[model samples]
Target chain A: MRSVLPVLTIVAFILGFWTLAVVPMNIHLAADQAARGDMVVEPDDARARQEVGAFALALGNPAVIPMTYTLDRPRLPGPQQVVVELWNTVFAVAPTSNRSLIYHGWVTLSATLLGFGMGTALGIALAVGIVFSRTMDLSVMPWAIASQTIPILALAPMIIVVMGALGIQGLLPKAIISAYLSFFPVVVGMVKGLRSPDAMQLDLLRTYSAGPAQGFWKLRLPASVPYLFASLKIGISASLVGAIVGELPTGARAGFGARMLVGDQYGQPLVTWAALFAAAITAAALVGLFAALERVTLKRMGMAA
Target chain B: MVSVDGNPQGLEHSAKTARSAVISASSVDLTFQTNDGPVHALKDVSLDIEKGDFVSFIGPSGCGKTTFLRCIAGLETPTGGALSVNGMTPDEARRARAYGYVFQAAGLYPWRTIGGNVKLPLEIMGYSKAEQEARVRRVLELVDLAGFARKYPWQLSGGMQQRASIARALAFDADILLMDEPFGALDEIVRDHLNEQLLQLWARTEKTIGFVTHSIPEAVYLSTKIVVMSPRPGRIADVIESTLPRERPLDIRDSPEFIAIAHRVRDGLRAGHADD
Candidate 1:
């Protein structure tokens, strides 16, 4: 409480100052649009231009949106309007209506869940393969890293096009993208964690006449829990990235990414920002859930969280 | 699993019903293939360990003390030698799980509780679950770690971890116990305390022990017979019989007899490693 107090106050102060600066400008712009008899002003139409224009014109920058423009051309949505719109979408429409926030969120959430699961499984299997084989370490590890070097931005469109040609339309490309992104960290982390049991620990197991499988199940796998969870956190976040990427290919008509795209087309910056925040919040919650699960499970197994 | 105290296993390299040496190493030589060259770790050494003797090996670094222990435990096979435990080869003896090895660093599995670590050998050796639990409890008591059975290794102090390791060794009741500097990392106070406890424990169990250490006082204090070793060809220099009594306490160090033995061990160590 004490640590966050001053920070909260500073944040509140910045927010207050920002509202003061922008709300009046929004009102002036709305007033000017009203004066011009125009009904709707695209949020992006004059955004960059207005800033430069205000600087250039210098006088009666009273062209400030809130105080001067017509009602439709309110230079920007005030923070309160954005919040109200966001709140309505989240609390009101999301929980109700057939075409709702939950409905759209489910589309992205399904992709994320499927992707995360596939990625984690594949990652663990690959890690096991890499750790157990010298040839795999020399070969597969480098290739896994190389696969990620190409930006997801480039990969997503190519995946969609290729996948569409193959008559594999839905879910597969998104999952593959997420798995592609998520598996690298899991493989790297699990390999390091699995191999963390040094020569002495291996020798100890050998002294027991433990077989290779026995040694792994009894020692190495348990030792790798912390690393696994750490990788899972990374993997889950990457799953969100893949879900959004899946949206970029054909400008998806649903999901948060789709919402943002629609908002951009309609010059609704407030809606776009709202969707981006939702996606971020969803990702944080997913990661947090995994963290809680890790703590409970690994702690029971006597591993450090 | 019954105690063989009445007819204690003795040392004899001959054909007889369980009458031969419990452990025999004749003309043993070990060479590790290193990047530099073949490290001549042990050279043409021979020794026999009786079933109920406190034997300690004192040597400099790279003097094959650990290698010898490993060989006996079947962790390392001798390059050239006829090594046997109860007339069987080291590999066969290991298949039978004939020895309990305690490494220098305790080597307790960090994920296991102290009691669970002690139970590991018994579990591997196919003890009944109840018997394993009983034996784990009994050994934890022997090492004075009865209350710490539930605690993980990292929770314990270094001395306590070592004692827990000793409990692990003792838990399975193996015929032989091989210790490689088991108390080497502890300070004087904990080492002395553990030494006394170990002597008492030795008196009680009478298990044949092959201990490896570099410290002169540690050599003189716990050993009944000390094998001094030299490096750079790694062979036994001398095997001196310690004249101390079986019941040694912490106060035994102040005694003139203990000091004389300490001096002799010091000289033996110097004579042993001086060539290196």
Candidate 2:
């Protein structure tokens, strides 16, 4: 109850503001339609009336003001309209059907999972390389950091075009872009974790006559668990964003990003807002799952997560 | 006062009277080349440690005692001179698992439980599971932590944690035990109790032990031989042989013989400072 109260209050506040915003955003069209209807003194000249602005006209007419919530094509959909659209798209169609939000969600989810796996592997490998070799530490670490500085927006289209040129149409190109965005965090995190063992601990390993492989397995790798899971959380969210971004530029016919693009092009704000909320919720669920895993792993390792 | 080269002869002659020498160092020196300049950590240090001897290196801070111990464990290499463990190079002896080392801090892996920490060296050396379990049990009992095997290192008191570290070193059953200020962090009462326990453990196992400490009473109470060292280019200031008997209780610290040996150690430390 303590945590939920603040969330509820914030949601109610946003909904109230959104309901008020709908009036102003759709007021012009509502007024124009009302002016051309039976209430108008003239048919063609009603919208061109001299005295009042559209907002003022809508405010004065009760019927016109109410039309803002009931518009078929609104600039910004009301909260109730978005909720209804979400309910219909998620439940009304078969899960495998193209029209269902579940089908689109699975498409995005597949790419995100695949990208996250590849990114995690690449990041850990690079981190190991950076930790053990001074050459890689001096050379590759700077490049890894520099790679993230390039805007993903600018990079995503280029990756899509390059993969399209190579005749790879779906999934792989998006996963590659996702891998590119996610690997940096894991690299930085694992480097710190691998080096977490202090001088005395290293000396202990030496006294045991343990080799580098033994040192890593017994000390560095186990030491890096908390860090690895922390990085994975950040990487997974970035992977989801990369998948959505990949869908935007490639003119995708399916997925959450495609649904948003289609709704935007057709001026159906309800579809777009519903898909946006679904993407957010999916990202939250992914982060939550990893958090659960981190708690278990760290606790088992005798580390307080 | 004996010169550095003159003292090793007397210690060797004494060591020859009872048991064979296990560790012999002659003019061993280590100078760390940091970015600022070369700083000498150990200089012209010579010593002979016999088998079954409880040898303690007592010194002020920056004394080469810890450095010399690390060199024995093959964690650091000396820049000059000869040091040997069990008739081989320090590195060779390390590879052969001839000694077990306890650091100044507990240094237990937090991810591992007390039993797991004790089993670590045995695991690395490829001991069978049953053997590893038996050894861990025996050492835990040796440290009086037999019931706390499943507890994490952080859950234990600092004194218990250090004992757990000692248990870890004892797990492998090596002939020599190298401990660097294992109880230096504990309270005085705890330190005294651990000292008594350590002496008992040493008596039972008869392991050749090399210990480092800053406390003169600790050195006098626990050692068959004491090597007093000084800082700023660390070197041995004095070597004192204890005439006290093997069996020592907590009250033995107040004996005149103990005080006489401690005073000699203090004079050696003063002499090292006078040279500086």
- For candidate 2, write residues A117-208 as lDDT tens digits: 99999999999999999999999998999999999989999999998999997899888888998998899999999999999899899899
- Give the 10-residue window scoring lowest on summed lDDT in candidate 1 chain A: A64-73
Query: DockQ scores for all the models shown?
Result: 0.42, 0.72
lDDT of 1 by residue, B7-116 (tens): 23311211231354578888899999999999899998887666677889988898888888888878898999889986788878777777777888987877789988
TM-score of 2: 0.91
Q: Which candidate is the best by TM-score?
A: 2
Q: Give the winner by lDDT.
A: 2
C-alpha lDDT of candidate 2 relative to the true structure: 0.88
DockQ, candidate 1, vs. native dimer: 0.42
TM-score of candidate 1 chain B vs. the reference: 0.89
> Per-residue lDDT tens digits of candidate 1, residues A136-203?
98999889989989989988889888988999866777777888888888999999989988777787
Docking class of 1: acceptable
